[model samples]
Target: MNCLQSVGHSRFSALPWPKRVDAHHRRTAVFNGFVGTGSLRVAAMKTSSNSRSSLYEDETEEQASSLDAKMTDLSDREEKSEIYSSNMTQAMGAVLTYRHELGMNYNFIRPDLIVGSCLQTPADVDKLRSVGVKTIFCLQQNPDLEYFRVDINAIQQYSKELNGIHHYRAEIRDFDAFDLRMRLPAVVSKLSKIVDINGGVTYIHCTAGLGRAPAVALTYMYWVLGYQLDDAHKLLQSKRPCFPKLDAIRSATADILVGQWKARVTFKWDGDDCSSVDISGLDIGWGQSIPLKFDEEQGAWLLERELPEGRYEYKYIVDGEWVYNSNELVTSPNMDGHVNNYIEVFNEDVNIEARQRRKKFMDGDAELTTDERKMIRQFLDSYKDDADLDEEEAEVRASATSDAIASGTIGVPDKA
Candidate 1:
């Protein structure tokens, strides 16, 4: 009998067993080409001795199970690596964006704690008290301009009555005009000392809480918050708007913070040739040191520190007497026809406020009628032609018109 017929199957039994065995061998050879030599060898061995065939089948089943487990392990490792990589990327991104690299978080300074002439209202004082503000630092020089005409004595009396709140005044006129070179470091030192002693919130303010306050605040943001100068300016504007009207102040502030400007001390006689008299007695507001520099050649005293953007009151010590610089330009008025020197530092908040105001007008939400619009345009055009209105005056006029419209004193035209 042929091998195939001997192995069983009716069709193969009818044929010569040898021919059927030959055909089965050919089929095995063809199948082996597709299934691989190892599988073919096992199948061939299965047909041989029964004991050897069983052993080969068991080996083949073991190899298949081993390969499946290996593939599962590789897939699991790949998934784990992908997850780890994604988490690492996110962590790196956060590290790059975080403001405080040394782990100090930015503490929010309560608005009420900040001392200012603008904050003289009863509601504002009450708010300050409620917030547990321990100290008020007034940076204003003139009591008349400052809403509350309370002197140092009055402030001390009030503090005594209030129990916890202490009041200190630094007659800093044009505080914003202090040269940032000398001013920034001195102010920062003073503020740090105050914070250490009070251990509570301290409010530092000048007239509008914009110029001097923002300058000092900006310095704090840089030293404490580790912010770059540009970023520091932006952060200050977010808290309080300070727009520098003076070009020098703007450039000086930028230079100081970015290390673009360096200050050197020099001493000489003025035009009067007064001996190097100690003007140290005069307080230009930022404690102790009289920031006077003598120019030997010009025979004039030049301020070593460039003032920050804002108005300032400064007097040169002539023959041991304090005297204002008549040549210095001023934007705000003072008592003696002497204008207070003003500087405008660039502030993003000013632009933001302007944009918001423009949007309100453009949206027609101000309820401006056609007649009112025509009148407003006429007024603006007239001022432009006359060259009569300064920026502040123009802004005041525009704001008044807008306020009137918003209050319904002006009406919009009906649409057909």
Candidate 2:
């Protein structure tokens, strides 16, 4: 029998104090070959004739079992619906965020980059046409007052003018917060598709050209240019000068950009491999050297190396003359106008600068130890500077050179 029928039988048996009579009633119903709804009615009649027990108990149990099965089915459907709804919401939110970050006051004048005075303006629209910007991604929710308010007709008109693509996404309430990690892939994917189809400039802007616009642009840089988070920030700052005012936005952008960069870019070495050196015991000065000992290989010398991420002041010593490498990459500016590269390592670790400072104080003179000198020299030679010495600077440099030689801080070249 079905679960409903079995539950009905159990309910009839559960009736109070009529143990003998209820058994007799059940036997009479069974002998009559009761079946279907008609049989249930017959069984009810027999039950009433014998005992005044609640006949509704059997019916109630059957109904309860049916209700439970229905509830389970409903629950499964609700779960699936909720999942679909949540996914749809997240996808819509990301699109809206991308548009808001990129759509405001977009200028097509600079086709390669989107220039925005604010988030929206007529001049920007004009510039977009001038630069042959084919796609306009509006991230602003309300070109009017409400977030949902959008200019569908105007967007359609613009699209017709260029016979290009126009997309508008709005950030609705209860929407997910902008997630760089989740959204970057979609943004990059969209950009790549746009570039592939149109092969023209794609301008991205937001209200202030500050938050989302910069973020989307940064993702492009990370994915397209293979820039690390720190490097990408520097590049964007150089281009726009104002981006990511809030610390949280800045931090989040950095994290997302780095994460994307790591996924997209891979590094390869083209030169000979050498031994590792510890320059932690060196003083900070212009001519200090850090020692490095590598396994000797015939016809193969260490061509270049990347220094640990930090600020370092170094000059190359080539053939006994203090020289600077013109080929090395640097991130920050020194006392000189030249830029120095930074190395940002994850995890809390020992400070290279602190170690160098301690070594400087303890050693008195800023001269590099035998081991320290080699490493520092190697670092400088790997990345050289080409700034020509002026007459006045040359004289001062000569004086310093003489002093260094006299103090045995720098070794003189052998005269053959």
Candidate 3:
């Protein structure tokens, strides 16, 4: 199977994080690919602490000077910070100016992060390494690499040979919005490990560096770096000329609040007489369906899958007829304006009070009470603690207490 289809399978999408690769196998693969290049020893795998020892090593005076200038400029900049994006529109003029400045496909969007097009040649790897990039993150699928004649095996070999730079790949399809949204969390998680845990200057790229690469970079800044979504977009736009699917990024960030929790969800249908039944949605992807097996014991058709905590809209196809749940309370209009059954799956860790407020908002109760608004705000703020572990333990504990208050496990004086 091609990389795109392979990644779409449960092996990748079913997890909250990327599947771990064995270090030995990876080392062996690198060794085998670079056997004739010269006397080259395979270094630590991406997950190895030994590899990160050299992340900031061999710094040239030019690189140091460049980094210092960047930091100084960043400190001097006065960008307004907010918890939410008041406006989501792109700055078209800034985008054009940045694109004009980006003569090459690659440019440093941040001090530690470089967003660029696919690395087409081994020289490209050398170019990036010369700038102190310790990690190369490729977001293109196998087919995309082949189309560009990008020798990925050679790129990996070159990255390994150059100060043991880490080469990581996420097989995301070109222009696939759904795949981008679904896989973005895992992408950002790996990027976080490289930049935060490993202390590496990471270069992220896709086929053209226009779509997936920028999207991942923007999401990282927004989700992990605590920039508001619009601020993150503006930051990236000011550096690189590209359009990331912002809506998908926003959706992914929304999912992150509860993405850590996955519960085995079962969809049941009382279609005993129907010849077949199918259940779909919540990572099954709308318009696609997986069959529900007959359950004689329960006297119903059942489909069970581990789903991350979120509200999912789905419909049942019984004997080739699409139908929503008869109970209108659980039914909502789908994108096509058709009524569909919706389910809110959550674990005990979920802040039920905040969830209830969100559900009320979703159910057309836009006039939320003062307490409800506060609960929702606290819920979002509490999850921001996961953005950075280096934050104070006391602050994290307080966020946890906020979560408890939102969950109604802790009582607070009625401020309203």
Candidate 4:
């Protein structure tokens, strides 16, 4: 069963069919059993005794011609519906393809995923890798050149094109079956991890990258791209010139992904009286701290990043001192045994930003960027700090700190 043996199951007939004519017996097999959901290569294995086996054993010349014509008509209509139909292929411009080899018509469905046909030549693989593709989603088994051409060796042949481009295969037989809906969560989750961690390009393809790949791509769009179901469908259609048939994507997958999107939260960070913000748990940069720009609207240094359901730890640096959240009774430790403040993100659809917007606290804040505000705050803080020192020393220290703050040499400090 794993090796693409024709099982003659009812599901096989539901797959994108290819016409196979038995020249000797004048019989035809339109649909066949699929290889497991490993890759897009539907290594079809046709059953020997078709239940609809016709008695064309003694077919005359006219009957054979008629059968051939019927097959041709069916194939032509199938082509018209394909994403790679000649008109659609030409309409997609250079961004898509339906060329001689494996007739792939790949186009970007999202910032993360590109859907298309199989890689026909080494150049095709090179083109993908050149643009920072880290993963390839193959839809077929070995040598479906009529649709696409690929094998482990064939894909591995161009390994140097990337930092070892990884290959993922998910054999698609029944796009709308309960099996597909059940598998959708795990598949979408893995794809989400790849896009989230790397933020790099991924090439997803079935032999044609049309029927099966688009279905999976649509799922990715809904779950990971943060798009609504209708939006995802429209975007996929605009790029590839077709969306998966209504039957290809089940309602359950749509509900799960759409629900996930609404459950996610936007984590916003605002730094006051600081030139930059650094986090110990995330990649701020290439081992460098990220500088935050003062946002006049927010009246603080702001950075907004999306966060999913998880526990994260972070600390803020203001005026060269770390501010730990007092909410945590006991901080968690990293492998190095150091402690940091933590927060748990849940599916509470609360808008922290909107509430904060109504209350603007410019009272004694020292992070103001305007020159007039800076001087006024500096004078007030100076008088407060100057009370403790001798007259001459207080005058000198006040001038030094004020000048340093004005010159951007040091971050301004607030009251003790």
Candidate 5:
């Protein structure tokens, strides 16, 4: 409920109560005291047109930093929740009728979307729109819709209304990296439409908005925000504190990163459940003549072999089915009337690739001890590029620079 004022009423009505077991049982609550003045920040929410910190008059600082946050305590949680909910009452109204602010359950990811729990009621939908949500992407199926219920017409009618919001759904299978990767194109395409056409804020959710939604959001961080994995994970955590600890997904994503779709190809096929997937390509020569067995530790059916630098058409044989890789590394028109997926090979620096991969695993500040990171962040918070400094400022600068030199980054550049 720590939001701006509510919007004027339109013909769009409240959402219907879903006919699922115990909707009340899973009531989402916000944590008030947990987000205030110190580590956590509430910046002007990100939008397509807004400048980097343009819209928000930070009740505090503008950006939430992953480097320095104290552990949130229960007493603080209770205290902050009361103060925040009191402020948000008018905006969230009865829809977000929980005791705490929304951050207990979700975060408004800057610049584009409100990544949060499934819309249980029209009230939640109203709460979202109150904060500039224009589109809703629900990834979970409403359990009530599985069979024709007695109130099917009314339910469908209500869903059609859905507060007059643009809604999309791309059913995700189980939460494996392979499944998520397969679904990425659809997810990206849908979100791209929202950005390209509607150009407003969006909300994407699953049943919990913790796992599936964030998985897709993390993918967006890599694709749209141009964030490496470390930065993306830190940024997501800094924004959505409740963001699920997806070590498996992280491991899978990291593992999957091993494969490159472009020149000097690296192809990965996550066939954990399947028997085999192979990179069958012309010009790669030998080894690929038969279906490739996926290396279990590799997390996918991986192919990294030296081939003369050039383009060549290829396809993945997954358990005997000829599947298009669709990564668009390369493609060609086949005589068989389908476009063949292809690969390109070029001399790549193995050492550089290794170093780049290593860099993705950790942020620049990762090597610093927690306390050192906090100290550096504090010093940086006061240091600004625009400001002119006097003697005291000069001393602080010199000392901080020396400390950095003593830290991990001051070492020799490694390339061999």
Candidate 6:
């Protein structure tokens, strides 16, 4: 079967004699082709079936009652032993056998990466190491480990001392999508580093290997391996059964446009008694217009809204006629193959006042001398012309230019 159906069938009965009734039935089943492995100890009931039958037929009512009480007492003791048992060997045996029967704990997503459930016991580390796993990356929080009875310290110690295997842990709360997204970067970065350094298989796991662990793996494929988000999900699901949260992975990678910092942009059209003045461009989709209200105080038509950090090309429609501000600081070719007024919205953190001040200067929202505006316009023009440069080289040049501008330098020439 189905992996979940198998797990539901065996979760309680996986261990030998966890229940008294199951224990009693095992004696008859053992003779009927029921094979037990060396790892698991299949215990049988102390009283034989023949004796049980005889006791029911020949024994007094009081004796039968006494036997029933004795069996109940035996069951209570067995249950206690099962709960209080800390024997690593027995736990490993049960975990291994359970994993074998269920057939869905772990699988190789990539040749170098195996993703699945947590290591249930210390010996699991050794078993994994035998399969050429040089690193074990766990994504369980402390409560999950305790609830699953996973002796993390023992596993770590055994991995280091017995096999020199590297074990790393990220405290990603199980089933919490927000926490998974927040912690994905550090976890993926660390996993990538370990895989590069170790050069062997890395086992990544959360509690059930379904949600958090799979999300991380999928994001790694998308962010690091350069797989498209959908393609990465398809490849991962093909390798192993999982329910990865795509939203969580997308959020971590900044693929969605929501939640980013937006700079307040004000579009101004200086005109008198226009029937309708509208601003239209790529930022708000072509042909769609946001109407600009006449500002009685500033004596102009103005539209203001927050726009995400990016370059946008927009033009004014003054009474149904397309118009461009020839004096605008920035201009770029539009989708309709016409030159249009543009502005650069820079990325900013949570400092609202600082962002507003920068926006005023860069977007021409503040008063500036004619010469100062011309200088600013020239830098933007040059920057747009060099847009096709490699990203790393552009970043270095941009940073150097920013510093030079702050130090009152006009421009710096390239070395060669």
Query: How far out, in Å, is residue 183 in model 2?
Result: 2.2
User: How close to the true structure is residue 328 of candidate 5, measured as C-alpha lDDT?
Assistant: 58
Model 1 weakest 10-residue run by lDDT:
1-10
- Per-structure clash totals for the candidates: 18, 32, 0, 11, 12, 0
lDDT digits (tens) for residues 32-120 of candidate 6: 24344331233344665977765643434444345445455545434432332222112111121113223227888888778887787
Q: 1-416 in candidate 4: lDDT tens per residue?
A: 00111122111111244534322333333322322221112332365765423332223334445645655554443443343333222221112333332234578776667998777566677678776776776655443434322345655556433343555554544222333444455455555544443346889886556555777788666544455556778788888764463332433332332222223433334545556654433222111234445677876665555543333445555555545545443365433344556555445554555223211221112122244334423332333212333453443345445545665877976879
Prediction 6 global C-alpha lDDT: 0.58
Model 5 C-alpha lDDT per residue in residues 85-134, reported as the tens digit of each score: 33233221222222221231458777776777655444565677677766
Whole-model lDDT values for every prediction = 0.41, 0.38, 0.58, 0.47, 0.47, 0.58
| TM-score of predicted structure 3 | 0.44
List, residue by residue over 304-371, the lDDT tens digit for candidate 2: 33322222333333333333334544344433333322222222243555444433422333323444
Model 4: weakest 10-residue lDDT segment is 1-10
Residue 308, model 5, lDDT: 37
lDDT score at residue 179, model 3, on the 0-100 scale: 66
Model 1 vs. true fold: TM = 0.33
- Residue by residue across 1-416, what tens digits does model 3's lDDT show? 00011111111111122542222222111222433111124233455565464552333333444534543333222111010010111111112111211223788888888998777677887788788876788998886666434589998887656542567786665655556777876667656655543354889898667778999988777656666567778889899878786655644554543234678877788857889998644465443578989999888888888876556666677887767768533543423345667676667766877556444433433333455334434443443324443343343345445645765877998888
Q: In model 4, what lDDT does residue 135 have? A: 70
Better of 2 and 3 by TM-score: 3
